[model samples]
Target chain A: MGSITLRAVSKTFGSTTVLRDINLVIQEGEFVVVVGPSGCGKSTLLRIVAGLERATSGHTLLDDRPIDNMPPYHRNIGMVFQNYALYPHMTVYDNLAFGMSAHKVPKKEIQTRIGQVAELLELQTLLRAKPSTLSGGQRQRVAVGRALVRQPHAFLMDEPLSNLDALLRERMRVELRRLHERLRIPTLYVTHDQTEAMTLADKLAVMRAGEVLQVGTPKTVYQQPATVFVAKFLGSPPMNLVRVESRTRGAMNPVGGAEEAVAMPAWIQEGWEDATDENGTIWCGFRPESVMKRRGPGGLEIPITVEAVETLGPRCHVHGSWGGQPITLTAEDGAMWTRGAVMRVAVPWDQVHWFHGRTERRIEPRPARLETLETGGAG
Target chain B: MSNRLSRLVPATAETPVRSAKPSHPEKHWRLPTDWREMLIGYGLILPSFWVFLVFYYGPAFFLFYIAFFHWNIFASQSQFVGLHNFAILFHQPVFWLSLFNTAYYVVLVVPVTTLLALALALLLRESAGLRGGGVTRALVFLPHVTPVVATSIIWVWIFNPNFGLANALLRVLHLPALNWLASTHWALPSVMIYTVWHSVGLYTVLFLAGLATIPRHVLEAAQMDGARGWLAFRRILWPLMGPITFFVVILVSINTMQTFSQIYTLTGGPHGGAGGPAFATTTDSLLIYQTAFLYLHFSLASAMSVVLFGLILALTLVQKLIADRFVFYR
Candidate 1:
């Protein structure tokens, strides 16, 4: 009953299309976080599901019933706004009770629900206090409490913790996850913060330019990004992407400038074993954490000149240029790497991601069986 | 003496002098550096204070002083009348009629103007995103900027009983035409209609400004809470608007109780000469003018002025008390 589905949804404001065709499904009791940069239509998509914005074309189904035509209140879904939007005139208890009272829930039931939500959110002592008198964290709790009191079929949060300080945002991120677990209500949360998207989502959706680029579990999306944009967006210090020309069966050269060839690891070579010709130019990507300083010949090695180093607690980021291309690699003991120093870094073939330069999409090798069938059909 | 001298003279780097004066255990007496700033602040306000003394407060005090005297401009000697003027005002039926008429006018105009202005402001706000909204707002506010007397004279024609626009509209609707402004029953009501029309625009503008200050998300949250339309207005908007609504009520009440020009100009001429049709439109302010200038009973007018001032002060204080208890400033 808690499942929500959006099918072929698109929205436009005047001449500008804010959201292209978007399809998503939130299974019952699942926590889905849509992550993207600003102006990416993530908030707009959440509003569409919350009934605050109407889709230009498509249907929104709740529990398999079309609910797009229903008003926000009739949909019985709770939404926490970015600003909290707590009534300044009302006390915390009254703010929590307002929605229930609007729905004409019995007075005793409203009281019971408010009591439970207050205890759950640790707002017992703050119920009679007005929102103006409460601190930001307290106000945030009251906002969540207000949404929680409805015992809603689903919850929608739009950057709820973006206003809080970093320390408090981290704590509230954990609290929000725990609250979702306890309530077990299907929730769709939207934020631009990568850490929140990575930690809080049962399923993550990465979006850009009015379209969802990829959706999967956090691990899968991080490990196997569907596009170059997804790969570049999800990780910190971001993934290093360099364009290269495949001139040999098991080696690649930096696209236009450097003449040095890089050896392809065994797994990639085995996947391309049946190919008659090398695929032209493609994008090679590897996470900063996957790059290791090496003096050996097993993996792809590129000589780089270090420009700067950033210390991040247990590790450091070495920013450098390899074959005229800027790259960053995470390393232990930042003291060992100095500015203007030249070093060799290597990445294993499995850790390397391949994307077509023209399409900017990941290039997965065709299975040998399928390759043979295509060859047979051509003959 | 040497310590005082050293304190007076500026010390250079080569002669950095330390005070040899013993520190007092008791309070020190010295002029503060900001004393000149305080003087300049007072000097800046002196002109405005002088103007208030000459125009507003001075006249009000003079009127209070004269309320106890039988003063005449031409007579060389004047006699102290004490409470006699007040006693005479109480016994006069015209004074009581004027008080009743003022009360009636206030009771009717204040609530009606406030409600109508709020409704119109809501409509304008809803239509603000649509085309021609700016023009419509200007049209609504245009009446407020036009001279009141000029508009009242024009309204005089609109409310004319015979061959007038008011009756013409009634006839077009197939409704029976009745004498307005000429009839005693309709004279006061006709003046009220004119007052509300002329002043509702200003209140509407104030309300529009108040509506603008409210955050849009609060209303959206209410909509999500199943409170729409009337329910939303009552529970969300009205309570949030407490401060502005209180201000509008007080302002409208004070203005309505003192209505004079529209009543004087609209109901003037052949039919009993303003506050006319057998004194149906004579409010307290109009009666005060008639008592002072027409009959040259300056003492009686002064006494009436004191009573009016007292009522306005008391009403404002009561509203302030209520506001402190109920109005939410933020």
Candidate 2:
């Protein structure tokens, strides 16, 4: 078990920076996943940690020992790649034994360690089978077993489940969680999948455009995203960002929303004065589930026309337009909504967020239900 | 009367005849007119087929047919000797000696060339994507695309006796460079050196292609497992290089057996040259040429051709049989 810390690490390929100022710590026995879009340098950061790619400038320390100069083997790092990368010619037994043999471990101990790992991965029955004959899932298990036999400092995984189908990916995600808990080794996993990050990571570093935008627990990052990019990136049917302009403190017109005018609540209005500019550009960001389906206290009912509806068993996505700008809200039932039907879109004042005109940082007016953010606000 | 019965009697009586008629329309049953265009397409390929029939199969069967008969350009009459030509070939000591020599050459060269090629390939593949890789590759490949005739001539000059640059360098270095081509002991080994040198480039490229297919992550994983250099090469690299080795072995064997041009150019056999004051430099092809064309012993030459063919076929089959044991497609 080890802790990995990167201090001011940055990597550049040619003129373009692949990663910038990436300072993160993976605590001992903690599983941290770095999540981002492709080209966002998530995998590059992982490679840097694995010693496969060197950082252009930075200090990376494992257990307080600088490992940036160490070769991969010398660093005692084990990496699980997206492709299993199992030696095709070797049987599962030899695949597990390869590292031990390379290190010149005794033959008897090699056999014993391989036997232990095979049993741990439940790969004993597959020990004699060649990699070519194994299914994708089994190959993945073998890859994990190969990593496990080394008992390295930490396991660095790069979207290791991306090759598996949906069902297997899910199964493997659970397997990985169980394995992490059982081993209690510090792990740094890289993935672009948000749900995987949410479920598997104790900490998430949300990266975008070569910079990490936010880093926190999954709940903290999702609930209080540091920037619009993080908020929009983390949620599916992503958070809706409606641009609004500040006019006379609280009252502002929606940017390019239909001519229908609406006023910000008195609390939202004060927050807007400090948060937004008079120039036509502040955005109100809200999640799909946060939008109210019915009129309630602290809600503003605005006119919206129903254009389309997608029924998913427990909840249906009601896709429509508000003031002629497209809006989608998750409705929790199958309601009879005719084509071109106009209805009230009640947005609870407490749930709506205000942001700066240029910078998309969330501006708070002390919403009633967010106890955590409120307490965090005190801090 | 039967036709009348077909109509007047129960219609079921003609059921078998009715079943025999075309079920679908005859126009549909015939292939489309597009077939005429297809035939025209195939007509375009006829020239290549004609070339193969004339140049490939033509010589193939003709060589065997001539092997059973004796023909001499200087003689007034060509005679059919049947198996007697073969009998005369079996009695020659040079026949067995040359066969033994050629097999020795193959044994010495093939394994060395294959191992060298694999090592060069691993080196080249590692340098892939690195700066200066293109220049490195070009340098490695220069000897291959260099005209073999020019290179062989260069080797001949380098192996020259007495006043030649080869022995002069040996004197300067205090190492004996035996007059290479002039010494019976050095000639065969010298030729193999040239052969191995030329063969390395082609096999190296083949191995490079094989190595490129090995996933980069696999190498990294091996590295993480503490496997590097020779251990990695032995465990991962060599086993996966099986297919390339198999291909190189077969190709080298075939080329070694058919190596006439270089040997002919270098030694010119005992009749044309001294053959190093012994017959050490004479290859099987050289002996056959001398017997059939030099001495008018066409029967003996014909018999030698059959033996050479047999040797080539046997080696090729043995390579295939051995290859099936180690080559892993996956």
- Which candidate ranks first by DockQ, i.e. highest? 2
TM-score (chain B) of candidate 2: 0.81
* Candidate 2 error regions (>4 Å): A265-279, A299-301, A336-338, A364-379, B1-44, B73-80, B168-172, B268-271, B274-277, B296-299
On the 0 to 100 scale, the lDDT of residue A342 in model 2 is 86
TM-score attained by model 1: 0.88
A1-379: candidate 2 lDDT, tens digit per residue = 7999999999999999998998899999999999999889999998899888999999999998999988887777788899989999999899999998888889999888888888888898999999999999999999998988888888899999999999999999999999998998899999999989999999988998888888899988888777778888898788877777654555665676545566677776655555655665777777888877678875656676889899989888888877666778887875766658888767877667666777777665565326647566410
- In candidate 1, which residue ranges exceed 4 Å CA deviation? A243-282, A295-298, A367-379, B1-33, B39-49, B75-80, B172-174, B269-272
Candidate 1 residue lDDT tens string, B174-224: 998877888888889888888888999999999999999999888888877
Report the lDDT of model 2 for residue A153.
87
TM-score, B chain alone, candidates in order: 0.88, 0.81
TM-score of each: 0.88, 0.89
Each candidate's fnat, listed in order, reads: 0.57, 0.76
Alpha-carbon shift of residue A260 in model 2 (angstroms): 3.7
Candidate 2's docking class is medium
